[model samples]
Structures are given as C-alpha cells and as structure tokens.
Target chain A: MTDMVMYEEEYRQIQEVCARLHRDANASAVLLIDKNGQLISEAGDTGHLDTTSLSSLTAGNVAATGGIASLLKEKEFTGQFHEGEQINVHISIVAQRVILVILFDERSSLGLVRLRVRRASDELSSVFDSLLAKVQQPSTPSIFSEITDEDIDNLFKD
Target chain B: MSFINYSSREINCKIVYYGPGLCGKTTNLQYIYARTNPDAKGKMISLATETERTLFFDFLPLSLGEIRGFKTRFHLYTVPGQVFYDASRKLILKGVDGVVFVADSQIERTEANIESFDNLEHNLYEQGYDLAKIPYVVQYNKRDLPNVAPIAELRDLINPEQVPEFEAVATTGYGVFDTLKAVAKLVLTELKRGR
Candidate 1:
C-alpha cells in the first residue's frame, strides 16, 4: 500500500490554496480530500456540514466515475458538478492523487468556480508533487525503528 | 494507503470488511457503529438499494484512541458482496491498508465464502497491493448457527496463512470488537515497521 505523508510545509500550502479557492470562486467552502477519501485540509464555511462523511462519499463518487471512464476508454472525468436547490458541489481531481471539492450556493456561478478551481489545482499539484518527493526520500529517518511492541500495546489498552 | 499527517498529528488508515452476500459484512460494521462512542465515530453511511442491500458500500470512520500523541483514526468500509457488484468492490479497495474478511461459516455458503475471498485477492492485486503483503485477518462469522462449519475446518479452508483468525457472531456483537482489534493491531504493527 502507498503511504501518504503530509509535512508541515505541505499543510500550509494546501491551506493557502483552499482559502484562495474559497474566496476567488465565491464558494461556501473548499475541501482538499485525498483520493482515498481522507480529508487533508478544509477552508471556508463548513460549519454546518459533515466534512468527514462528505469527503468519503465524494471519493467514492470519483472512484465510481473513474470506473465509468475506463469503460468508455477514457482516462478520467476531471470535473463533476451537482446542482442542488440551494447549494451545489463541484469536484475535480488534482495531481491524480487528491480531490478538490467546492461547495457553492446561488452567490457563486459555475463558471467562476471552474476557473478558480483550475488555477488552484495547478498550484496544489506542485505542492503535492514536492510532498510526495519528500515522503519517498530514502535519506529520511525511519519513524518506526524506535517504536517497541509495548508502545503498540499501550495504544489499545482500555 | 495510510495517511500520516505530522502537521495534524493524525494517522488515518482504511480497513474494508469483505465477504459474500448477506454474510454479515454490514452486520459487523453495524455492531461497531452501535458500540462506538458518538464522539469517537462519524455517522455511519450505507449506500444501499431500496431493499437495504448494500448498493455501493457502507462507510464508518472511527477513532481508536490516540497513540504517541497521534490520533489513530480508521476508516471502516464494507464492499457490496453480491457477485454483480464486483466493480464496486474493486473501487472500494483502492487504498485499503488492511482487510477483515468476514467469512460466512454456514455450511451452504462455503463456496460463496471462497469465491469472495478469491475476488478480494484479485481486486487488491489490481490496485497494486499483494494480499499477503498487507495487514489482514479473517473472521469466521455466524458461529451461533447450528449448520455452520467447524472452526478447525473453516480455519484450514479460509485462513491457510493463519493470520489471527477469530470466530464471530456479528449480529449479537460477539467477537466483533475482538476481530476488529486483532486486524487493527496488525495494521499498527505494520506501520511501526515503517510500511
């Protein structure tokens, strides 16, 4: 299994990208989720929403859509939009490893969201590319060598 | 794939419950959801059909306490077990860090159990994961049923690798946490070995 490691530097970059996406697109919120459905970073007004479950479901939706893309002999559907009565969602794959999900209402237009997301996606892709390189560095010290069996048992102790 | 965030002090790992149709994969998740503290778990979401059969998957995000200042969160998922839903099953295994195969112990469902297990292996392989190399465990479920296979026979047939198999009756919550704990421990141990 591939491991996803987020260093402090990458977190700051992702937060900046998300904040810009939220403001520039006039969207309610911008969430950066891993393709595996883990919420990496979130910005904007997500107070009333359940980001955890939303992230997981969004990833599932993307994966299902990607499956459809394969059947159609395409690489992937880069963007998806779901219009709702009050709010709408726009999801896009960034760097092929992360998902950019934006939630907007009548205040924002689909055209604006797409434009901002595309720009932010490119910035985020570079940030993630560096993060991936750092994680794959062979010179990095091991996080587990010092961990003992007792350390693991202590975690599950009731 | 396990996501370790040094910035947030969180470690998120995906664990998928897999088995044949109506073989208690969803039941295992339901038991865990019911037992888990509300503060420690997210809402349980089931993407199912009108008949309540899982259509895509059932998702439960759980926090199993913290370890060394890092919150250990496990995202639990169950793949739809019907043969026709094989596509959905493969999609769910995309970044799985570990698997808990809930094999139906009923005598009549023996073949279904084997087929599902084989399918799991194939799907994992397609996603660039070798089943044997990843953290995994097996659960012989529905042990309370009188028509179930014996533990010894089930172990020989289902758990040839002997990866911490457990006997469970998920509906009653019997051995459910035990099975979960076993696989989670293996996953954490693997992480300690630096992936």
Candidate 2:
C-alpha cells in the first residue's frame, strides 16, 4: 500500500535547502508546511523537538495571526514575528499553501530570517509545487514506499 | 563581504522531540540553551497556553561545529505531549529527521510513555518515513526522580530496538548533552548512508 503521507521526497529536498537557510541566516529552526498546514519538511536540531505538534501549532498561529492582520487592515500577514527574551519564532506562509516557520535564538535577528525567508519561500514553493505535481502525476512507487512488515521485521532484526 | 550569508545554503532538516507530557523535552532544549555558546544558536521560541502547558512546541537551533566543509547544525523542537494534542503531534512529524524519544521514567507515567511511542511510529508511517530508516534514539529522562521506573523496564518497553539510548535528568542538565550528541551523531551518520 502506498504511504498516505505526501511530499516526502520534496520535503527531503527542502530539508537540504532549509539547512542552508538556517546556517546562513543564523536562525535556530526552519519548518516548511503545506497550505493545509501539513508539514512537508524541516531543518535544524530536533534533539528535543516534537515537530509533529509544532507544525500544526505553527499553521494555526499563521491562520489566527493572519486573520488578525486582515482585520487590522495591515498587510496580509506573510509572516509573524514573536520576540522573546531567549527565543523567537518567525512564521511565513509561502504561495498561500505552504508556511515556513523559523525558530531562532537572540543571536539571530527577525530582520535577517524574514529577509532570507521571503526569498526562500518563493524558491521553496516553486520547487515543492513541481514536486507535488510530480507526485500527483506519476503514481509510481519507489523502494522508499515499499514499507511492509518484512521491512520493519528485517530492520529490527539488524 | 559578510562572513556568513543566510541565503547561501539550501538544505534544511526539521526534527521533533517525541515523548509523553512533562518528559523534559522542553527542559532538554532549555538546558542546551543554557550551555550553548552565543552565535551558534538562535532564539528559543515557546508557544504556551494560559495554563503554561506547551500549547504548541518549543524550538531552538544548535550548531554542532562543522564536519568536512558543510556546517552541521540542528533545529531542536518539542511537542506538547498531552494526548488530546494528537493532531498537533501529527503536524510536527510531517517532515523530520533524527528523533529523540524522551521517555518519562516515573513508574506511573509508563502508559503515557508507551502510548507516545506508538503515536510516534504511527505518525512516521503516515509521513512515509520508516522509523528504521530515520536517525533515531531513546532517552529515559528523569533519572533523578525518586519514583522513576527502573531502567530495565523502561528499556524493554521503549528501547526494544535499541537504536541508542541515554539516561537523563533534563531539568538539572544531566544527560542533555549526551542525548544531543547521540542524535547529532545519528543525523550525520545518516548523511553518509543516504547523502
């Protein structure tokens, strides 16, 4: 059976790009999600991370914060900047369907992450949009999706 | 000529700490932050509810020096462990690499620990990542707790596959680095095989 999760390969590709973005921008973590808020991929240390939960939270934040932005008649929120004493989150939605969330410490600047992400968002959307389209079209299976009891069994046996 | 250019690099990896509630996932990152040298880490962000529970997640970034020419860094994250937050957990696991399954060692929290582990596997399958293929580790935290579960039982229940495991007291900073080191090593090792 095909794994229901979409964007695995695309997200994998994006992970590399996000890693570069994190290093270059001096940010903490970077998250990329679909418009529906399904997480596609991420970069940074996940040693203490439960990203499954974080992606939804980030999408929700974007939706709620975006609504407030619309109501306030501010520029529709392309992103959000939350400043804290130690850590901060920069939330940006790309191509309206994907949201890019950046986690950074005080050493990283909101200005820097925002600047780089604006460009990264567009680049990422273009790349992912194509990948999503590819997944929709081919419907071909790769060794990756060949997950089965045997696969799990053999892996565990090792 | 800026020494570091944010736009230059292109690869990003997202990792989430999967564990039961109050298992010190957040505390692990907190301890890392306390010890991390400035310039290597960015801000730490927490999304919390009025009750102070981790409403969403805690995020932090750490630079693991450099290997070869490319810089090896990690983005640390913690999910809200409450069972009701399953949807949130599902979202964060969307795209992840190297997971540190932080288990609460308290005997009473055993059920929570097991449930979360199952949830972690389920979520990964949904994301199309076989737990075996991804860089993985287990951390039996709260070693300092007086009523903690014995390490043997904890190991059997959670670390059955024995990818790698650590004993920790995240709140006091013990075992935090060990856990990070283990995961970082796994992530890098993955680069060798997959990259």
Candidate 3:
C-alpha cells in the first residue's frame, strides 16, 4: 500500500464535503477514516466521542467483513448499518481506500443519510484522486527528508 | 501505510503485534497503555471473548510526541495469536507499517514460535510486503519463566535476518519500551528512506 499524503487544498475540499453532508443529512456526526484506521477528517458532534477508538474499531469491522466477502467470492461488502435505541451508524467504503461513517438519531432517517452519503462519497473520491496525483509528483519533497538521525534519537531521549 | 496530514500537522502509522497463542502480545500493549500518560493515549479497546482471549484484535492509539512540527501518532494493534485465528491475524496485518513478533520463549513453545514466524512471513508475502523489507522486530517474551529457552537459540530459530530483538517479561514490563522504541524508530527511519 502506498502512503496516504493529504495536502491542504484537498483537505479543505474534503472538509467541505463532510460539512455539507452533515448538514444535508441532518446527521449527528460524520467521520472519514483510512482503511488503516487513521482518522482523516471528521465533522459534526464529535467532541464527546472517542474518535480514535471508533476509527480503529470501524476499520477492524470493515476488514473482518471484507474477509467474509472474499470467502464468498465477492469483491467486498461496502456498506453496514448498526441501529440502536438512541443512535444509528451508517458505514460505507469510498473508492476502496477510506471509510465514510454517518451517525444519526431521531433527527435523521436512514434513507436521507444514505442518499447524502452517496453524493458525498463521489465527491470525496474525486478529491482523493487529485490528492493522489499530487502525492505522486516526484517534485514534491517529503517533510521528513530534512530530518537527521539526531532528530530520531532525540525522540527516544527521556 | 502511514498517513501524513499536512493540514493537521500530524503523521499516523499502524504497527501490529503478531505471534502464537498466549505469547503476551496483548500483555505488551496492556503495559504500554497502563504506563502512558492519559493525554498521550486514547482508550484501549480489546475485542475479546468472555474468557479474555482476543476474539479479534486489541487496539491502542498513542501519540509519541512530535517529530519536527508534526505530531507523531501510532495506532498499535495486537492480533489474536491462537493458531485458529489465522484469518484474524491476516486482517490485522493489512496496511501495517511495522511489525513486532512476540515469541513465547518457553522451551516447549519453540515449535509454536517457529510456526508463527513462518505464518507471519507468509501472510506478509500475501500482502506484497517482504518480511525483510518491512520495518520489523522480534521480542522473546516470557523470559522470566524458568523453562524458557536461551535467547541465542530463539534468535537463531526465528530471527535469521538479525533484526533488532528484545528479551522481555511482559507482565513486569521488562524490555517492553525497548522493543516498542526500536520498532517505532525503524518505522520512522523507513519513512525517511521512502522519500
């Protein structure tokens, strides 16, 4: 797998899409996580949630479901929903690289969330396409390129 | 695969702990979680059976301070090490930036260690990551046990690549951070080289 490098331009674009989706779907929260369980960006009421754990667990759930799909000779199982008394979670994979999660309660219905996510997923995927191109440019130097061995050692220094 | 977010000035990498059953993979993560400052770590999540054996994986997200202006974060995961959990192991290894193979060092567990090592290599190969190319380390755990094998013997058996290896009693936290720091450093060094 190639490293995922996000630039400011694409990040802003992604943030816009998430924000719009959150508003349009009337969702309580929205999160975009990489398949490796890294939180890329999040929107809505996330301050009270432990997003780190949520991202990791959601990725694990996706990975496990993907495994099950392969066993059945399918490419992947891209969408999952978990309903609860007070909340509901809608999860889907975008461009096979990142997960899109929308959490809603009585304020939003499943149909509305799914409809808004379908549009947001396409927008996010296009943003990622451009981001990937930017990352692949050889002229773009890595931030770590200037780091010295001393820097790494100092991190371990107590 | 590492994720670098310029907007957030954050760098996140995934490191997986792999080994055979009851080999202390989970224990190693537990020690780190308990010892880390609350601000530097998120909640530790263990997807385990009622008996506490890991049903899927254990996850711990840690922030290892900063490198340059970028905040360095690592999501550590421990796969269920039981022999029957091969599918779960492979799933956890996906997108891994580094690996720590926790070997059960007890003499009778020698064969299990080798089998698990081979499994690690095979699973990595399936994902197109060469065992030699990836940032990897070995930890011989259960060193406090009286029946444990010699470190030299264990190294020769599982670590022919001469990768950094540590001796540890995970329950007591010996060599735990040493092993973590070694692999984390290797991962960052590899990232630098990739550029």
Candidate 4:
C-alpha cells in the first residue's frame, strides 16, 4: 500500500495547479482526485455539485477504463473526454496515481480544455511525484504511532 | 491506499464491502447512511438495475469525527456481487484499504459463499494486494433468517484466518455498526503501523 501524505507546501502547489486549470480552460470546476476516489484538492465552482460523489464515480470510471485498456493490451487511457449535450467532463491521469477532472458546460471547448489540462497535468504530476518521494523517505515518522488507543476511541465518540 | 491531507487535516481511507450476490452488502451501506449524522456523511450513490440490484457499485462517504485533529473520513463501496459482474468487482477492489466480507448466513448458499470468498482473494491478488496484508473483517449477515449456519461453522469456512468477525442483520441495523467499527479500527491500526 502506498501512503499519500500531502504537506502544506504540496497542497498549495496542487491548489495552484488546479486553479490555473480552471482559469485557463474556463472550466466550471477542477478537481484533483486520487485514483482511489479521495478528493485531494479542488478549484472553481463546486457550490452545487456533489464533489464527493463525483470524485468517487470519476475514479470508478477511470478504473473501469483501465481494465479495458489492459484487455486491449494497452497500458492505460491517460486522457479521456466525454461530451454531453450541455456539460462535459475531461479526465486526465496524473503520475498514474491521481486524476485531474475538469467539469465544464457549453462555456468551454474540448480542444481548449485538453490543451490546458496537458500543461496542468504535467505540473501536478511533478508535485505529486515529489510528494510521493517525501512519503517514501524512511526517516519520515509514522503519524499514527504517537496516538493512543483513547484517541482512536474518541474519534467514535458522539 | 490511505491519503492524508495536512492542509485539510484529514485522513481518508477506502473500505470495500464484498460478498456473494444478495448477501446484504448494499443493506449495510444503507443502514449506515440512515443512522449516521447528516454532517458526518455524504450522499449515497447507487448505480443499479431497474429492479434495484446493484449494477456497478454503491458508494457512501463517511467522516468519523477527528483523530488527533485530523478528520478520519471513510469511503465505503459495495461491488456488484453477481457472478457475471466479475470485471466490475475486480475494478472496485483497486486501492482498497480494508475489506468487509459480508457472507450470507443461510445454509443453502454455502457454496456461493465459498466461491465468492475465493473470487475476492483472486481479485485482490490480481490488483497486487495480498488479502492477508490488508486489514479485513467478516460479517455473517442475515442471521435473523432461518436455516442459518452456526457461527462456528461460518467462521471455520469463511474466516479461518480468524480476523474480526460479526453477526449482522443489516436491514434492521443489528450489528451493522459493530461490523463497520471493527473493520475501521483495523484500517486505522494498519495506518498507524505505516502499512
């Protein structure tokens, strides 16, 4: 199992990348979702959207696509764009661990979204690569080791 | 995979509920969704057939307060358990942090239980995850029904490794939270050990 620990600096960097993607692509929202369906960061308009559910479903979609890729003898689908009558979702795989999902309506074109996502994905990939390196360092302390059983029990407290 | 975000001070873990078809996997999620505080849970999503049988999966995102200032969020997923949905089941197991094997307790489905358990092992292995290394628990669901197998029999067959196991009737919420808590606890312990 790989541990994904995102420190403040890395989080800020990812936030900036997502914000830039939202701005440059004129997207409704941009989300950085882990391949396991956790939301790492978000930017732009997500007020009404259920980003949590969206993130989970997005990762599921990516996994299903990956299964198909394997069946076809391809590595994986690094980029996918789904067009809708009004809304569109563009997903790009980053560092093979995280997914960048850009949600847009008629406001943005697929060509522009793809172009911006390419740049943003590269930036996000580098940031996450470094993050993974930091997590992998042997010297990094285990955050859970210090917490007591009581602390864990308290989490279940109402 | 477990994700810890220092910026938000949150730890997110993925827990997948797996078992044979009609083993009460979805019922477990539904019970949790109904009983949990609204602030602690996100909307439940179910992609199911018109008859309400799960087609792809059911997802429920839950936040269990905070541990050492970091919110502990758990994403619960139930894969489609029908035999023909093997591909879908395999996809759902990717990156799973913990697993709850919800076995049907009825004696008539003994073979189905064994077959599904084997399928779970094979699918996890294909994803490069060893079942023994991952935090796992077993739930003997539908215990309220007649002709249920004895707890010892179920344990011997499905839980030979002797990880935490619970008896549950998910529809009425009996033992539902107990099963969830047991698996969640193991997941946290695994995290603490830096797994």
Candidates 3 and 4 compared: the better one by TM-score is 3
Compared with the true structure, what per-residue lDDT tens digits does model 4 show for residues B95-181? 899999999999999999999999999999987998888899999999899899999999888898999999999999999999999
Question: Which candidate, 1 or 4, has the higher TM-score?
Answer: 1
**How well does model 1 score by local distance difference test?**
0.91
Which residue pairs show collisions in model 3?
Answer: none
Model 1 error, position B13 (Å): 0.2
lDDT of 1 by residue, B1-195 (tens): 899998998989999999999999999999999999999999999999999999999999999987777899999999999999999999999888889999999999999998998898899888788888889999999999999988888888778888888889999999899889888898989888863
Cα-based lDDT at residue A18, candidate 3: 96
B20-103 in candidate 2: lDDT tens per residue? 998889889889998888877766778878876887788786665543233445667788899998777776665466799999
Best by DockQ: 3
User: How high a TM-score does candidate 1 get?
Assistant: 0.98
Q: Model 3 — TM-score against the truth?
A: 0.99
> Per-residue CA lDDT of candidate 3, range A1-158, in tens?
67999988999999999999999999999999999899999999999999999999999999999999999999999899999999999999998899999999999999999999999999999999988888988998788898778888888998
3 or 4: which has the higher lDDT? Answer: 3
DockQ of each: 0.77, 0.06, 0.91, 0.76
TM-score of the first chain in candidate 4 relative to the native first chain: 0.94
Model 4: which residue pairs collide?
none
Docking class of 4: medium
After superposition, the stretches of candidate 2 with alpha carbons farther than 4 Å from their true spots are A1-158, B1-7
